[model samples]
Target chain A: MSVLVYTENWNGKFKKLSFELASYASRLAEMLNMDPIAVSIGQVDRDELEKLAGYGIKKMIAIENDALKQFDTQTYTKVIADIASRESAKLLVLANNNAGKSLAPRLSVRLKAAVASGVGQLPEKLSPFVIKKRVFSGNALAGLELRTETKIITLAQNSFDLIEKPADMVIEKAEADLAGIAPKTSIKDVQIQTGKLLLSDAEIVVSGGRGMKSPDNWGPIEELAGLLNGATACSRPVSDEGWRPHEEHTGQTGKIIAPNLYFAIGISGATQHLAGISASKYIVAINNDKDAPIFEAAQYGIVGDATKVLPKLVEALRKAKSA
Target chain B: MNILVCISQVPDTTTKVKFTDNNTRLDTTGIQWVINPWDELSLTRALELKDDASSGVAKVSVALVGPVSTEPTIRKALAIGADDAYRVDTEALDAYQVAAQLAEVVKAGSFDIILCGIESSDYNGSNVGGMLAEFLNYPSVSGISNLDVKDGQVQVSREIDGGKEMIALPTPFVGIVQKGIAKEPRIAAMRGIMMARKKPIQIVESAPVEPLSQTLAFEPPQPRPACNFIDPDNPEQLITLLQNEAKVI
Candidate 1:
């Protein structure tokens, strides 16, 4: 059979995670000698799904309906499970987004399969059912296997980079019956009531700590994060001190992330904090303390005051880009 | 409310995780154990419910399935304000097995509402709550940051990818509590400790339903490479380093 991937979106528009999931499913399908099929849902159109051909997807199947606009978990789960059953899909993949958060488990139950969430890589596919996934909130990797015939796994956001191929892939819409059931849950409104910070899927992350001193002075960090098209994160102390919302906290106790570039500003990293993002490709620590623990884990360290250094770095990037 | 709160005693978060001599087994000696930090949030919330319902009127019970070392952790829940506690005295630690234990306990109690940590601090698997829901055949909402109960139902708002998701579920459902639930957990006071003396801890011996796929030894990550300091003031030098030395940009 083939591998099935769930496409993701934000405000009815395709998101970066859709491409990443397609890429991951493509590779996993290759390793398993199976074809890759992406099931694009929500307000996404066929053209948007077909555009993911660059990720090496063989076919894009769109399931369109007005009720399918927002992320209603019951209807979404029903649609996915129904499609996977018809395809006899061996492995079902989903992006570890909020939609997948509730949908994955519900889909797993409907399909009667074992689910492995937060997966980081393809399985061994040999005698054992081994797949390496991040555990303990990305602190460590667990080598696990799914012995069940029908397997479902969710990919951690940004764990895999999509390769862009020039040739276009085929697109087809699937007319599926999700059956009749009143949705017990409702997504009332799409609230875009946050700042410029998009932590879950940002490529670059600029985080602050207790060193920022106060919330009023956080304007510079926010500006730098905005300029870089990155997100803002914080250490435990900052969240603990209420300088930033606890939702922004990234650590073993908070949300785990793995951005391409992580900028630690005025924060001394702790192991618990490092557990959340040690997978970041490049880490830059900007702390005045020469012996801060973050420096030990950081690829590049800046031993200077953040107040004096961050502004100049921002200015330098802007000037260098123009000149 | 028939509040059934599930907990697991894990190595304290601050512990320096070290492998044993063979680099296989985790170093067990002298490691302090506490309720998983996320699970502690569930305890805090459960206690709040108990206080709100006036104790015996609407009952609260703590359920855990782990080794006997978790007795104190169960007692800690009692001290924190659960009416009683139950610990499945088994050595199995697999996610499926643990979820089965919770399912059996849930089926027996017929809870109106259930609360559990989103994931275990030690296992970090984040599968138990979902697995329990799957086994017991019920709906579950996880990663809940703030929750309240009203009108024969519970309402919860969870931290989603870009924003927040709020859902309200009727009785007979599970909600996995997230860390930093509400605010910092309150300390166990002298009264809680005194009341815990009267609470009974019931231990049951039950066979594991099924073990999960094998898990390899815990491996502490390799130490990071040496840090290279650059002067942020010298943008030219930093840019060169990023391009040539680190090659991140």
Candidate 2:
């Protein structure tokens, strides 16, 4: 039996997430005393595939097909299930991102493998296979047990560190027969957001809430984010009131992010909002209310009017960068 | 055309989560139940489609896998203009079990369009819609932000890695929706609330499907250190602390 990891690529290039999955799978393979194998679908360069070797992935399978160019959950699940069965994979690991979330459940059904989504930690026990994951939107943690012969897990992003253990890797080409299979859905158009750091991929995030007072008062938030080379986000009410785009909303109902540094300006943190950013390494909150819930979760806080404090902080940051 | 929206009852967002029974179960004391926020938005979108005559949407129904205690939350969905509801008589143990149960409901009542929230706020499992589609052998679209149906054709815009992708699919598909499916969830009107009392809630026996995973225990997140308050009068000091102390900037 082998441990299999699915490495996802975008535009024929792998991201840091793929390396993280490889690192996770290598450690898991060690625990189970099994070989670690990675499967990369779509088009990726051979040199790029060699990068997995640094994370201890020795065997890699590449499946290139015109029909598999676009991501279809159903088709991808079928392909991965075939690989898992052929390799006799006892455990399958995937990143808990958009594509992974869409594919894991279907694969679970196809393989009849018990799935534990958003797992944050490695398993401490293998007899009954128990792991921990965030629950109640990060308000709490739940310990879960997988009671099946085969197991599948989706690792939460940024939860595991990428540890390099160099190894000699071999690439294998596999062809999937798609004669009678076809996707029921087709992509009519794709609009990729360009020239901006995506919130999910950012290390620092500057966010605001209703306390910013008006949509017109967003200049400081943008300026601060630009100076820090970070992304900008907002609370749900800010998006609901049209102060910011819905895509910028961060909460339990919206995007969940875990940046290295998060600035919550003029935002009184609600539980739902806190849930989204709880994974952040360090949180800094600025609010007029000293008792705002955001302060409780933040590592550093400034209790004053954001309108008075924001511009001054921006100027200070500008000067510091130049110094 | 017929539409079905799956709903789940969750603790109010403001309610503080607490565990009982040696951290094995959620404490229900003093807790207020409400419809999952994402499910509410999905139901709102379904009703909006039914409200339009040109869309040819004739009925909007809801389904839930819960016990009798969840009826109040199910009634709230009907009050918000769902024509009727189906309640599977059992507590949802896991995502697979819940999806299996919901598949039976969908098989019994033929629905052209099915809507499910991306994930429940309580468990944040994010598995049901895709698993349910697999159970019924139907196509499913995840991360749906906008959905429109015209002339019996279903089109949805889903959020991908950096942007959105517009997809066109036929009938009998599942849409796992997040925010932006509707501008905002609609509030129940007085007349709608009064009429909802007469609507029927069909209770089906739970299917004998075993759960794939089990929850061992629950615990609160580790508490953060106390906040170090920087003097607001000296705004530059905060930047210095961030640079020299926090080292984030």
**Whole-model Cα lDDT of every candidate shown, in order:** 0.74, 0.89
Give the CAPRI class of candidate 2: medium
User: What CAPRI class is candidate 1?
Assistant: acceptable
- Candidate 1 clashing pairs? A136-B124
Whole-structure CA lDDT of model 2: 0.89
Candidate 1 lDDT, A199-258, residue by residue in tens: 756778889887777777687788778767788998889898898987788887776777
Scanning candidate 2 chain A in windows of ten residues, the lowest lDDT window is: A193-202
lDDT of 1 by residue, B1-249 (tens): 678889888887777776676654667888887887777778778777667753332778889997788788887888878889888889755666787787888887768778888777666666677667766656667677877775455667765545666777666777777765656665778998888888988887786465645565555555678888787678567766766776555
DockQ of 2: 0.67
DockQ of 1: 0.44
> Can you tell me which runs of candidate 2 are displaced by over 4 Å?
A197-203, A226-229, A315-323, B228-249
Candidate 1 total steric clashes: 1
